[model samples]
Target: MSPRNKNTMLVKLRNDSQWSSWTWQQKLRLHGKHGLTRFFPNIRRKVNEQYIKYIKSYKIEITPYLLSLIDYDSQGNPQKNDPIWKQVSHIDLLSNVKSADYNGVNLNWEMPEEIHYSILHHKYPDRAIIRLTDNCLGYCSYCYLAQRTLDKKRKTLSSSFQIKWNGTLEYLRKNRQIRDILLSGGDPLLFSNRRLDQLFKDIKDIESISTIRINTRALTFNPFRFDPELIRIFKKYGLTALEVHFAHPKEITQEVDDALSLMDDIGYRPIILWRSPLLKGINDSCGILEELLVKLYERRIVPYYLFHYAPYSPARSNLSTSVKKGVRLLSELRRKIPGIAFPRYTLFHSSGKHDIPLVQEGTNEFKYEILANKQYIVKFKNWKDNWVIYPDLQDN
Candidate 1:
């Protein structure tokens, strides 16, 4: 390990040999995190075999940096209620829960209106996304894509996304309507720098494509990946911005700040923006989120979108906060924090993005009004003509 940077309390850089020796998978293994083995010996000894079998059903991976943040006693007993642990570690409550696909974004493959290619999803004419890989440095327990990855019958990574590069590019060139291309997957940053360099170089030249964004969680897992060479490539290619996923304030450490600072020096204004699902018990409180959002703005990272947790399955249903609760929380934050510091609390539906109703002026009591089977034309206070229908109010 190298000495820590004086200004920020993170390691300046790892030695060359130290960096080369450990692959990403090797780091996971060394941290005792690939499977149930990361649990304390006492817990593992007492846990039932059925519980162990349940955890094995889904995928789980934790990075070295993240593992260090988990709280444990001197005797190596992992804490049961730690927020970081809740995000990745499996709980007994999910054992009997049936698996489900909540978002149905994958069903886009069946719709031919905008999906010109099998792997690409173009919900709108002007925007599209390319999935680069099915691998990520850290795996969140509530990940939407986990449904596909856990299914043995389906292939998560297909040749269409990887091998048919020329054909995909040709489709983009022919349409001339796509102005934005977002590279995402398990995490695009997990792709090799050389591979990313080639992809950026190819996309930057397309006249129709004006903005490119890389969605990643690497800053939380492996900040060192943002080395000087990678920074240089992003600058050369005129990379628009990066959307990073961070669920809790504890995840924002000095190391993460140092990584953002690297992008700051390269003339990347508002370089990084954050997007996170509001998970119950983890980051649902106004105090936790208020502090996290303020810290983000101070670091030059904009609070982009705070998503309402999707009701994916019976197992994950507890994570979804009710619309009434979400609105009340956002209303509280709006009252205390500056408007610029607040993020749009939204629900993602097949139709479009609908802002969760913030306040009902006349009523002194704050509560959700259930409008039955009605189509709502949700309007934006700031932007005229920008609106989406409320898909359903029954759930509220």
Candidate 2:
């Protein structure tokens, strides 16, 4: 691993996550609810089957609060931890390896000077993605980048964001054809308000970088970072737009709600991104997803992408859902739910936005399907008008 891949202590903590507020003793007492032990058997064992595997996978410390959410009861089954189970307990997804199709979603020639180091991935020329930084406030057990981050050699590689920051900025500055820049990866807000300001400042200065978007979860796990001063800085950077990543309804709390409201007050209204892989006993049910979407609407958050877990990292073997099946779940949920709360269904593929998915289609453009059944067909009533062309593309 080059020096560029190294991650900071905070970022490293993310890959090897831990709930700083709690103690290990407390965690053991509440590792599971009801009789979760019998089902997974050995979870509580000093060196249980799952724990040993998780350690090998390089998964960070699991907080007791999160552990308490798991189900151990005879009747609880895997569904008990549906919302968060797949994030960590993904032994099944890794077993089924599905190849990725990198077609229409190609980020194009903006493909960059370096393949492995380039954070930018622009599939639809209409919009471009800027993998601005490679760091996070906290890491998830099911993170696709787990292997990429855990390899000591890749540690500096993970921190490549800081290393390439200048070159990437230069590339964006020269590309006038690009209109939108999605600030992604390692959660942008994990940085200090001042650091975020400098980033947005550079971005806003660019003539082509019109809309600024970011994907983050600091508001959920570390709302303190969403301070008024930080929001104040964001409010000052009019070019930046905020996007929140929420895996399930359980992730939304009053604190998060207040933080979003604060963002609105400070000038950046956020779009909510709900993503998680479909684990067997976890959140595969149409009813559960529908309910979660409804909750999102209640809070005035626009539900963006509801994703089917893809095969990546240690959890991939245990957590992935079938392309056909994922599509089906989305179709069923859409039919049973209202449009206001329904989110756009999509999946991550090498091609970028392979809507529909490996099974069917998100559209002639794309669709986010869970099962082959195509249960949720996400369509915007006036989808065409929701966004305006970048002017240059109108004639293309």
Which candidate number maximizes TM-score? 1
Residue 325 shift from truth in candidate 2, angstroms: 2.2
Candidate 1 lDDT over residue span 1-396, tens digit each: 211112121121232244422244336432222245443444555443534554455555665556556666444545666677777765454654432223333431224565445546677778888767666776676765555543224466655555556666888888799989988877788767798899988887789999999888877666767776788888888788889888898888877876777777875543677998887788888999999899888887889899875444323554655565677788888877777778988765544444566764312222343334343223232223333332222233
Question: Which sections of candidate 2 miss by over 4 Å?
Answer: 1-43, 46-57, 61-82, 89-117, 146-153, 158-163, 265-267, 271-279, 357-396
lDDT of candidate 2 over 157-181, digit per residue (tens): 3445675777777777776777887
TM-score of every candidate relative to the true structure: 0.79, 0.67
Each prediction's number of clashing residue pairs: 0, 66
- Model 1 residue runs over 4 Å out of place are 1-26, 29-34, 46-52, 91-93, 96-116, 149-153, 158-161, 265-270, 313-315, 360-396
What's the true lDDT of residue 362 in model 2?
Answer: 34
lDDT score, candidate 1: 0.63
How much is 210 displaced in model 1, in angstroms? 0.8
Taking every candidate in turn, the Cα RMSD to the unseen true structure, in Å, is: 6.1, 11.0
